[model samples]
Target: MSAPANYPIESVENAARVLLMLRDRRDLRVADVAVELGIARSSAHRMLTTLQSQGLLQQKPTRVYAAGPQLVQIGVAVIGATDLRAVARPTLERLRRHLGETVHLIILDGSTIVFLDGVEGTFAIRAAERTGDRAPAHPSAAGKVLLASLTREQLRERYPSSRLRGGTTAAKKSRRMLEDELEIVRSQGHAVNLGESEIGLHALAVPVRDSAGNARAAISVSGPSVRLTEDKLTEHVPVLLQAADQLGASLS
Candidate 1:
């Protein structure tokens, strides 16, 4: 037996296609959209203009269009509504237990990292609950792991200026510095924060990649710098990588 045929509204489908294209391409010109959709330039312009008017897209000075703030808001809402935290909690708990340090699941939002969930360690003094808190990306292990997943073009689009919002004396202060750090993150498949986000705190993070190999989120273990020593960080990296792999598999 065959399934019944379904109907899709042409304009709505076209708009959704445009959105998907923008997601993969990062930015688009009307001509690019036209070629992708096999639509006339005028029709593509009309669609893009409508999307821009509705705040789903924005045009840059270069005349290329990218996702607008409204789309990002919608994405955040969708991510919030998803069961990603629930899906990741088991692995997070396991890592926390094994490391005896707080384990966190974080996602990137623009140039910042938002803590979605966390598992506290058994230590009398450890990193506190950071769930729902936001922090600058360049200063956190989770943030650097997430940022390392982006292409250079995407990074430039996100940070057009060289100067970055300072988080601490240890934080990367410029795009050049961040790019250099990100290269290390990419090569190592993880990142470490040495009191960059907060004084006397230390963290190590690994990216939880999706099936497409994009860093959908990051898993991190954090504690007081005194106990989470350089040797401890070296010891914890393989364990973190294992947990991240399990979490990514589950997510996929």
Candidate 2:
């Protein structure tokens, strides 16, 4: 038989509840937390500050608490480690077949984009597989799509400086430029890399969102710019979005 329930520690339970609350709501102030938890404002502030100290939460400019990088990283790591690749592989393969280009499953790790898995196209001049590869997030379609999911404060936290760096000259030169591009990605629900990661490469990506409407990963198609021209990349958006939705549903 399974273990029976024991006496619950109230503080620990409250802490867990706070985390759970943050998971659903984007922001919380001390008063909001106190009222919801039926605790004093001082108690709520103490709890929030403690979690912030442990890197489980962050305080925004508006003095509201948001999920911190450590919390997000832990969630992303779990998604990447367990069901993500296995669940996404079939969808990626089907997308590759449909698009006739390399398809990659990517997740954000701070300012980096890690290629968790990929299905390489059969064409002789296709983009290479990038499974287990890490690239600068600012210069890749998959990276930008994932980045666009973050709040403006989160983006600023990730990139504090104006100057940026990447492997290719076409990469966004500053945080301002990157934020602008991310805004476009957010508005369009997709991102594109036209020779931004490499001189002759082009790619397009859409977000694989979880039930909470947060991006857990990105699905991308990449090929040589000669074949995947700007117009062609635009043409692939609808199908890519379909694949992302399929993958997101499976993950959920």
Candidate 3:
């Protein structure tokens, strides 16, 4: 027998309802599902058992059903897709408007930093838009901020060689030096690049953290060194931090 195309399957609808209810609360009980879906307790129990078998829900010792591993994995993937660039674009644009400097959303990829999106500054002599560009992770402010989130073991894995290679003389020359710089970045909760990527180019970055307080990405503002002096960069930290928090909250 063929099912009607326009009609919703009762079992699927009930299962979706249970999932939605779980979203609003920490867990769900069969009795609660029964009442919410206007179904019998036995029917609710069967539905929950099926969902649990499918790994969408787990039955706890307390007799409650909570999100299972598969559901959690799906939620994490959705957050990743939502956080990448589109979700951060508005924050990037607002930061550029406020600071009048080029703003970039970036992520660390192995030993490289990939620019996911960027907004050009209003000034004529400003950092160029770096969307789709990749650079060594040890030099750029955003790269440093993201790297600071990793453990020492992870850092060593990414940079096995003691000597760090970069485009310019200002870049960190040794892995030990880079590690020390990352420690400072972790302590200060931000990062700075003063002509490390290129002479006379300055940048500042703050991390956009996830629900676990780990950096999922970084937001950076870049401009000429003369305009973004050390003092000016320090002054801009508050604004960048606020924007980073906003982006992080959106993902959460």
Candidate 4:
């Protein structure tokens, strides 16, 4: 199809605008681009086509667009592949031994949790069968602890009050309940998961703050409640807290 009359010329200035628009969104559809710039759909399509051909934009299965592999490759170089795993390995081992359960180092990526690394205990039965998994912020142990570090405004932006959904059927929490839980988290400087993410899984987590005192990630211990009794969790709290304190001591 031909470019629409409303399309800005294929000049360096307009190309710069194209990059800016893409930079602002993780995903954009053809219609969204047209509406944002007051351009016709055909014009936006042509621009997207050119960008895709040149390896700047990628079209998903649903035809929504995101930054292409080229940009991801560039991002890899710029982000320097920081090895948080290496930095926290010894700490995780110590925490796992103290808790006698699986310990996780999870990073908050956007409103979701990314399990960057995990150390499974020697126990025969464990709750989380996943490593390198991702989960929503409101439900998971590490996720909530990290979420609690953010401000109420940030929580609203990430998990809006209107769309709040409780965790698993066993441990359902409404928006107000979650807000209350967050307040508790802020007060204790730790978060608890009582079969919220999964049935029979009990977890406790503390924020792994940086040298700047900002919670960048969380360290969590999860296990089967039978072995991971309430008393066990209470006993392990100080251990987890101290380990997190050590992890934050170096990274500014």
Highest lDDT: give the candidate number.
3
Ranking by TM-score: 1, 2, 3, 4
The digit string of per-residue lDDT tens for model 2 on 76-95 reads 47755547877898999999
Residues 163-207 of candidate 1 have per-residue lDDT tens digits of: 998578988889999999999999989999999988899999999
User: On a 0 to 100 scale, what is the lDDT of residue 251 in model 3?
Assistant: 77
**Candidate 4 collision pairs:** none
lDDT on C-alpha atoms for all candidate structures: 0.85, 0.86, 0.87, 0.75
What would you estimate as the lDDT of candidate 3?
0.87
Residue 34 error for model 4, in Å? Answer: 34
TM-score of each: 0.69, 0.69, 0.68, 0.66
The clash count for each model shown is: 0, 0, 0, 0
For each candidate in turn, give its C-alpha RMSD to the true structure in angstroms.
13.2, 14.6, 16.9, 8.8
> Which residues of candidate 2, in runs, are more than 4 Å off?
1-80
lDDT of 3 by residue, 208-244 (tens): 9977798989999999999999999999999999999
lDDT of 1: 0.85
Question: TM-score for model 3?
Answer: 0.68
